[model samples]
Target: MQKKLVCNTLKVQWRTAKLLIFAQNLTMGTIMAKESYSAVLITQGEHRFYQLAMPSDVLSSCTFVSTRDEDPDKGFQRLLDKKRAKEIATYIDSGHGTIPTSIILSAQEICGLEYDSRNKTISFEVLSGSFLILDGQHRVFGFKLAETKIRVPVIIYDGLSRRDESRLFIDINSKQRGVPSELLLDIKKQADYENSEEQLFREVFDKMNGDPNSPLFGRLSPSKRVKSKISRVTFNAALKSIYPALTSRTPGEIQEILSEYLASVRDQIIRNGGDENILLNSITFRAIVSFFIHAARRVKDRFGPEYTIDNFDVVLGPLFDNIQIAKLSGTSQSKILDYLEKHFKGEFQL
Candidate 1:
């Protein structure tokens, strides 16, 4: 039988944690070439791992999905000084800092991996758009920009939910004494004072952030810190979108209704493989929730005193049935206004 494979298999170890790593013998310094490789894919409780090597050949293809504070000028991970990367590169080229001491990285959706674990090595092609750099954006991009190639190690956590990826990033960088992580934590606290709906929004955001079943879990920036993709500003804005409708609703009541709605949207997004895109943004979330509170009054009145998923979905089903996230993402302001006014024609009033 001709053994079918994509890339070669190799052995890897880390103090009793052994991995049958899949690797390639692609020529060094040819990072830009369209090359293919293989990986050892492992599945663990809603998470995937693709243990592989780090080189320009691989890093060049990987995307950087950063949780860094994005500045329009400096962009994500603004603290990543090119001078620092240059220093590292110079040290490497000088043959002194040959081994990267504590470089840590995490990635999502390794196209270079298989879905499940069967104890068999899987082959993966190293191609552009194969992965995302959840952490270590500088070192990875630094090496790529440095005009030199060095083989570093990487932990490619394939098929990771955004929350898990964020957690891993926090774990790696925080333990490394990353100043940014500490600052983010500090900022997380100060965010509450900066806003009017901070109390209600924080409660809702915290529940969603902590709940594993929640789609927004791990994806919300609670500290206004450099964690997760979504920000507290977005969350606060979402509340403000529904602020007028929230006259009598407590935070817990709001949490229950939003949780169910988010779970549905999240599942739909994941099912469609739309997780990578900025699909669940402030506009869509705010608009949908606003529409729900505006339109679900019949259900609320009939059900009496409390809101429920059934009540939300009665209106949500008809409204959201017409709403496709991929199609509606980044929708224009006029369209959003039109959408809100359309279904809310006969909504229950506060």
Candidate 2:
């Protein structure tokens, strides 16, 4: 059966050297997709699997969703504000000044492809149950509610495996906002998340709050909402100090060690008196993280790689045990930092 050309919005382009050399057989390495959905696919990259797909159709056939680092298993996140979505829908349906922005997606396969020599077009078929949105959740949601026919533009990365998808999710989520969240929850899930070292810090930050056994669970405040008073920015800033030495550890490994340290030492510090959440104090958390790095770096310099996580508690445990908060109530955070810093440098080994 001939797949229908619903509109002329799709323009075929290729980014592959091999495909360009064999222009006559452009679809040679293409994956076969569904018979119903075909697009003008052009390879324009170092890899054969990456292509530009212009699907000249609305989003009615597709589903829209968001991911959360806090919990991917939790139900999909809130869609665009209904009022905003409706406003965008009106503009889209009206078809005035509608130069559409692209929504990005990643999918597992391309079932089939065939180059149309006569019409100079390329038709593609995407395998079913394989579409995941990496960016532009709102634009897709807006188009879905449009009243009139509108062919939404899409950039779909084809032939991506699950691992590839997760990494791509992190790359896109780190620099972009109001998008994907599962891959790097600590930062990607938060609206104010940043890139570079902060990305690593955010991942570890989120893990401490979201991981099941985390000592900081329900402690850090996410930018999207204020669940706790612990400043995500301040804590993340403090984390950057230790970021340089974190090269050899994965986020999980670091999270475990840090959380364990907190659990072991919480009893010694006077964060609160009774029935009060003293952990919400920004200065205390920041001071603790900063001093840990100061002490850990010293340990690393002396012990070299011999300082294993196996004995983290053996060495760093009692160091925190010396904390004696003179007064938890009305105590300035600066005093806490000074005290922690003194203790951190004073208690070098034990």
Name the candidate that leads on lDDT. 2
**What are the runs in model 1 whose C-alpha is more than 4 Å off?**
1-196, 224-228, 264-279, 323-327, 343-350
Model 2 CA deviation exceeding 4 Å by range: 1-193, 224-229, 270-277, 297-323, 327-335, 344-350
Candidate 2, residue 297: the lDDT equals 66
State each candidate's clash count. 2, 16
Q: Residues 1-350, candidate 2, lDDT per residue (tens digit)?
A: 12434332222233355456566444553334343333445565532332333433434344345456434754234444677767777877776737366677765344344445455554445433345666666666666667665555666666766666666667766776653232344445464546667667777877887887776787666554354556567667667766777767988878886775566445444322232355556665666666666556655676664444434455555555664453332356556666666676685334
lDDT of 1 by residue, 21-71 (tens): 221223432233333334556566666665655566467655554435663
| Residue pairs in collision within model 1 | 38-124, 188-223
lDDT against the true structure, per candidate, is 0.56, 0.57
Maximum-TM-score candidate: 1
TM-score of each: 0.38, 0.38
Model 2 residue 40 lDDT score: 49
- Alpha-carbon error at 178 in model 2, in Å? 16
